[model samples]
Target: MARKTFNAQAHSLCLLVLVIVDAAAARGDVVSANASGEAMAQREFDYFALALQWPGSYCQRTRHCCSSSACCQSNPLAEFTIHGLWPDYNDGHYPSCCRDSDFSIKKISSLMPELQKHWPSLSCGSPSLCHGGKGIRQIFLYLNRNLLRSQFPDEKKHGTCSYPVILDEYSYFSVALDLYFKYNITKILSNEGILASNAETYSVEDIISAIKKAVGALPLLECRRGNGLNGDASSAISWLIVNEPFAPFNVL
Candidate 1:
């Protein structure tokens, strides 16, 4: 397959990567065959696309800022956050809203802290109501309620399609969290002296090489034109196809 490359224009930063995983292996089950000797393991999707987003770039492009939004918080995030985990096909097509599963905050209560820190919602909510002078307890309640509502769409859309491999909403989110931490892109870039800066500019090859060295694969870069403070740009690593030995698919 021909690998795709996105040129880093004005101010590009690595946003996300679509990592591929074997469905059967992910479920920890051996493939079965029917009476006619046909493989019974029919995969609903080809791979998982783990999309991440840079808070700086997202906030910059967002014109309306709400107090409840992560970008408008007292201490805005300085790191990339989880955007979504989508089930995609190799042919550039995908499925959504596969099943009717209601998202529950209580199921992932333990992960709230990490989710809030790493997967916060960028979209605006009822700022006045979210930040209303209601007591600390009331504010917490409101935020939790909002979180459930915000996360439901994703669970219903993408998470549901993940099916047997991911199981439920908790698993869907937890798996993404695990992958995000396992491949710490920010740390990887910093190690190569590719720190986010307004005055400094980096070569696209250097950025790709740095990530390839760290992750054992080439990453796709994407740049956007916006009213960024210093021509801030973003890059996205297309797809990482994973097999038994966990080798990265050659994108060259």
Candidate 2:
């Protein structure tokens, strides 16, 4: 009878020990998950920088415009296109390719029409039937495939890392387009009599002033050596950087 009693107590103790271990393991998993969440939260960028690219300057500087880009004679666009909205550290260094997210056409479906008009792909497989040219499924599929190469990195690297930043993927791209509409540098320069022309070179300081006066804030101006015939002629193209990540972007 004593032996049987001891056996029962041992079986009960074993079951109790198993239950305690399971509870400890569950708590450990929760702790690990919380730590991971905190780490990803810390990965949020310090600031956001919107980089605008001018096709005229790009074609001039490169000396070779892609047949599909805005610089194409068949479809010249005076307005600047979005180069990227980068996540930057205050000191100027930026982070990129931080995470991976599948490129979903549905995510950008609504923006496709506008993107074709404004952010047309620079390089393409079928240049003759570029998205703006043929307007068919072939071109559509091509953009979906090539966006991963040409322009989808923003979502992967910066956008995904931007936790608690904004609404979602749609919001991210839309906000950028909204900012583009608000700051039309071409219009600002024209008002200041600093028009874009290969014939006459405009001073960089004047260009910066034109933008600042319009926006009521300072900007970061970047220049590139033109590959155009007037490469030496003050016809260099300039890029502007406007990202204040710590603060919310008030697109007005």
Residue 16's lDDT in candidate 1: 61
Q: Compared to the true structure, candidate 1 yields what TM-score?
A: 0.72
Per-residue alpha-carbon lDDT of model 1 for 1-252, expressed as tens digits?
324333322233346664646436344222323334343443467667676766676666557865446766777566767777777666777655444434455766777788777777776643222112222223234444544223334534455567767776677768878878876777877899877665566665676777777887665455554453344334444433446322345322
Assess every candidate by TM-score: 0.72, 0.61
lDDT of each: 0.56, 0.44
Q: List residue ranges in candidate 1 displaced over 4 A.
A: 1-14, 23-43, 102-104, 125-152, 229-241, 245-252
lDDT of 2 by residue, 122-240 (tens): 44333221112221223234454533224443334444433335445666677667766666655776788865454555555565566667865544544434443233222222233
Q: Looking at model 1, which ten-residue stretch has the lowest summed lDDT?
A: 128-137
How well does model 2 score by local distance difference test? 0.44
Q: In model 2, which runs have C-alpha deviations exceeding 4 angstroms?
A: 1-42, 60-73, 124-149, 229-252
Clashing pairs in 1: 11-232, 11-233, 12-233, 12-234, 13-233, 13-234, 13-235
